[model samples]
Target: MIVETTRPATTRRAARLRGALLWAAVAPGCAWAAVRLGGLDRGPLVQLLAFTPYAAAGSLLPLLLALALRRRGPAVVAALASAALVAVVAPRALPSGQPPAAGPTVRLLTANLLAGAGDAGALVDLVRRHRVDVLAVQEFTPAAEVELQRLGLDGLLPHRQLSPSIGTVGSGLYARFPISAGGVRHNRGGWGFDQAHGTVAVPGAPAIRVESAHPSAPYAVDQVGHWRTDLAAQPPATPGGPLGILAGDFNATLDHGPLRALLDTGYVDAADQVGAGLVGTWGPYDGDWIPPVTIDHVLVDRRIAVRSVAVHRVPGSDHRAVLAELRLPAG
Candidate 1:
């Protein structure tokens, strides 16, 4: 005869507690993804909280969850709650407009014309059509610069600051208004491209400080951490001003930690400000299965009001252009 034995109450309680802890650990990632989906501002703290599990994936959390709670029902429920939170919060964060009463509205266009992109002529046409007030270009080659000038952009926009470094394959800022002082940052990396900043005179309005940055692409976990550190060290060149703007190929998504840090500094993203849906700027050159990412961005300080923001498709570059119209508050 065999005796039937039951597990002790302590064992059952321990298993349940373990399951609850595992579920809690996985819940934050779902919340993070949901925040991004709901268009809520993902700050550095949020990113840190969300990415901890993925960063420490080699540990026991996933393994235990797989062995004990294979169903993942609790995880699914947590993710759904996170998504619902995003839906509730996104609408309220958007900016509200009064009327079109404007003093000087600056229409700026920022583009990352890929180094070898063959669509320079198409880009020129776009500039003329849009009547762009200030144009900030990244991945700007010397050859492209000459071609752009030949296409009559120089005539349209006389004031300019170009750092066509062969070593860096850098950026160029061309403006319709006079540029007071402009220079590239001293920091140099493996890519050799330095950050570019300038002050553009807006006539009756305040001078706007603009920075064109192309930080290293954070494809790996370490790279993402490095980007965060670099961004924190190098702040925008907003010299005692109420208005500042930074626009370029940030090389990171809105969900990324470094980008969130930039947003937390009281600067409003022009795309989010205008309520434009997620605008994907980067695509594979050969058009592969890789999904498009919105690595490009235009962020403005709170004092400067955003009228509208749009992404313009340029023919040759793998990245699209971001156009933003900013309204300065009445004096």
Candidate 2:
């Protein structure tokens, strides 16, 4: 005789509920993981989700699950947790140091001149109008450099360092102040993980250590993982009294883990401190058709005070220029 066996109806119902809730809890996390793994670009939908991956994981994912399961508490709790995590983690990702002074300040301007762009004249005009104290630029092609020099930037920013490799346009740092010493650091092959460091002199203040970096964009899995490892391999800021400021086209957004490591190390974001709006710096040529993203950044140590931050539009480059005014603490 065949024996009939059946599980309890209540137990089966409970198991089904638990499984549904588990999927709901993990769906958004999966999406967030995908984005972190470099699966999305700087489009509107992706940008919005990118800005708040935790929300996607917590709120959106749970809501989607709730629609099918008729449960709201789990989703609400998950969203709150995600939001809290973002709030807690974001500020920590920025560089932190002493606050800025209420007195005189130094102005810095940075841009990534797309190698093929031909509008050096417009860039020169922007530079002249701003009279920036230090100029940190990436994607500096030879022709672009010549045009910039012709526009009088060479005269204005006499002290300069140009990288040897033209591929990825390398990187460049120009300053009105004397550069005691500077050179490229962490030369990763074909990755464009280049950096330029120099010293800036401010009246009545000690020399400040500045570094301009352009890390690889991390288009593939290995690239993204390698970039993160590269960032991790970065040595801690040298022990010195001078404040540290690192600015450049990072090629990654604020949400990425590599950037998060910088912030966690006590770097304060100049734009965030000065309440600068969402200054998307890429895809200017596409107009409303293409989405915008703020991959370029100016991050300072906590000891510095941020006065203002703005993005200046230029004709030739895809990225808008980032200008920031910061005050160093008196010695």
Candidate 3:
């Protein structure tokens, strides 16, 4: 009789275990890949794309397992999934392609004041340290405004465009250069925050259109639609027109479709242009596991070259402050 060659029982069991582990790991990775690629705006599932970076990095674990088990098929699938995720998100980490322009460097600072709870002294110190030419504040309460004036921000900045509110909607723009009143408007059913825009006239340079944006947070299921509309309320950069500078608590990340759409308006986030987009600007002050993410941004006209960008803690506010140094074309 002819004997048939058969694998040992332990080898078969081991192969089954390995295969099980591979699928267990690959399943979650594949789900993330789907959201990242398709961008199906199905609320909760869509939110998972926000952490695609972490998912991309963590997906490699399965690939490693596949290698150890000599599972070629699963290894290939895992490798492709992980590569696609990284490829999609990798652009955010790359520096902008635009060459540095020949212009005066403008130091800008933006922060969320936590409805009068943020530390005015600390903010002032940061401004002084950076020699900021422009400052945009969000969630500026009456108390925060009073504190700023009390703390001599008016003297240092000289010009102001304040839109104070009781809660998260307030904002302000303080600048060393001359700034004309750019009315505080909340045109989106009072759901959008009071965004204060002003024309900043820089000496020997183009007058930059500056705005302070504090759109409603999209944390809850009900608020999600309002949040999208609020972000859309902000006008896109006027093509072939004056360079507009927008900075504040957008409450939306690059992963969010609405925010990405906003960028399609011919503006670029300073942090993204300088390879710091992945570096988050929101987190617990005491360094909790809250997993910091970027929601605050300085969207500038594409003409301006982003030199460098950094984030600092905003006391009393869950959101951090963004500091960006931009090179504007000289007049």
Candidate 4:
């Protein structure tokens, strides 16, 4: 009789312990979901938020654990949180519909040259093989420009608006088509990176303005504010104005608030449109051993049709090059 009584009590304790364990499993994911959905990222949270994709993937484990433990409350919470995160992230993997577009197709490539240390031969080879029409380069340096020209970059892309400096602040735009009214804009609110801009005149389409975007990276806690300011200062896509494309290392991901806010202004991520958004363009290439994340992007006017997007590995650079084939509307 005593054995039976003790067995029942032990079972009760075991059940309680399992329930507690389940709650512990599900709580962190739930909190992350709350913060992400609520857009509560600020200060250090900005940097932490870059790992949302990982968080979303991880939320599944706790969900499965809760279901296995048969903890109803924790399971339900986990399910909801997991669903919310997957809903936001999964769309990037699926192709979105494109608008009806009948115009000339243009191939664009964007790359961060890692302060001009990236392989110039590899870059020019990509341009040549891909038949790229526009090339946006970030972290462009004067030495890099000369080396690229030596490798036949100028022959491939005759028109240019370059602002090549000694460090990561420089940017440039090179085009196969004629480019006019080209210049560089220095960031007023951020770390003052130069953004090279130009108006490209494609033969059969309306003149489109292109900018090589290089926002301040949020590496440090204090630099988060500068990062936000840099993103906010990016030019918006105006329907009535010239069609636009912003490409390069934005130092931000789609999950970031400031980047999302910029996207809200009538711009579309080319990779996301063709379901290639999840591909990482930056990370551990410099021997950091970190997992890659998507930061470099080609954001086009919503009216433009994105046919396909590809990411390529550039030797000696931490960033992968992003190539996008886009169709612009007729003038």
**Model 1 misses residue 289 by how many Å?**
1.7
Q: How many Å off is the CA of 98 in candidate 2?
A: 6.5
**Considering every candidate listed, which one attains the maximal TM-score?**
4
TM-score of each: 0.73, 0.75, 0.92, 0.96
Looking at model 1, residue 157 earns an lDDT score of 85
Of the pair 1 and 3, which is ahead by TM-score? 3
lDDT of 2 by residue, 1-331 (tens): 1232344666788878886766657566545544544535333333444355234335455545655665566555555545554554355335444464644487888888776373777766766788788888777767777778888988888988766235464577888878867876764633645677788776766677787767766555446555555555543444344567888877666666567677667776788676553557676565666566677888787767887788888776788889998887775
Per-residue CA lDDT of model 3 for 1-331, tens digit only, reads 1223345666788879878878888878877887777765556654555567788889889988888888898888898888888887778899878655787889999998878788999999898889999999988888899988898888889898888889777889999999975778674723567888899988767889999888877676677777778888887897699879889888777777778888999899899998888987877557687677788999998888888999988778787899999888887
Clashing pairs in 1: none
lDDT (Cα, 0-100) at 135 in candidate 4? 98
How displaced is residue 113 in candidate 1, in Å? 1.4
Write candidate 4's Cα lDDT for 1-331 as tens digits.
Answer: 9999999999999999988888988998898889888887788888777888888999999999989877789999999999998888899999999977788999999999999999999999999999999999999999999999999999999999999999888899999999999999898655679999999999989999999999998888888888888898999998778899999999888888889999999999999999999999998676676778999999999999999999999998999999999998987
Candidate 4: 10-residue stretch with minimal lDDT: 283-292
Judge candidate 2 at residue 37 and give its lDDT. 47
The C-alpha stretches of model 3 lying farther than 4 A from their native spots are: 1-14, 187-191
TM-score result, candidate 2: 0.75
Residue 114, candidate 4: C-alpha displacement in angstroms: 0.7
Task: Provide the overall lDDT of each model, using Cα atoms, as 2-decimal numbers.
Answer: 0.67, 0.66, 0.83, 0.92
Please give the distance, in angstroms, between residue 51's alpha carbon in candidate 2 and its true position after superposition.
Answer: 4.6
RMSD of each: 7.0, 6.5, 2.7, 1.4
